[model samples]
Target: MSIEEKVTSIIVDQLGVEKDKVKPEASFVDDLGADSMDVVELVMAFEDNFSVQIPDQEENNIRTVQDAIDFIKENQKA
Candidate 1:
């Protein structure tokens, strides 16, 4: 499956959110209602699930779902 789908599933499972609500434009805070801790958990979940380490400097660059998708796609290729 694509990275977007995988990431979306993680967000849904972790945050108890409906699968349909994880659109690319949905903001983690304003749209998805994720708090700071949830955001942290989401990042960690992505890192763990993909077995890729997201550097602290790069983490800030992943503000949107598409950004995460791109990061995973580019980094997860061994």
Candidate 2:
């Protein structure tokens, strides 16, 4: 699967939300009903799945589904 598909899958599984709601523009907190702890877990899940380290500073900026997908695409290990 592509990076977008992988990221969307992770988001749906991590957040316990429907796949249809995992849109690129969806916000983890506002749109997806994720709390702060959920965001942290989601980041950890992303790191584990994609084998990339997301810095704390960068993690804070990852508010939307597109942000996580972009970060993973840009930083995933070769």
Tell me, by TM-score, which candidate is best.
2
Q: Write the per-residue lDDT of candidate 2 for residues 1-78, one digit (tens) a residue.
A: 999999999998999999999999999999999999999999999999999999999999999999999998889989
4-72 per-residue lDDT for model 1 (tens digits): 889999989888889998888777777788887888898999989999889988877877777788889
Q: Where does model 1 exceed 4 Å of error? A: none
Q: What is the lDDT of candidate 1?
A: 0.85
TM-score for each model = 0.87, 0.97
Worst 10 residues of 1 by lDDT: 59-68
lDDT scores of the candidates, listed in order: 0.85, 0.96
Q: Using alpha carbons, what is the TM-score of model 2?
A: 0.97
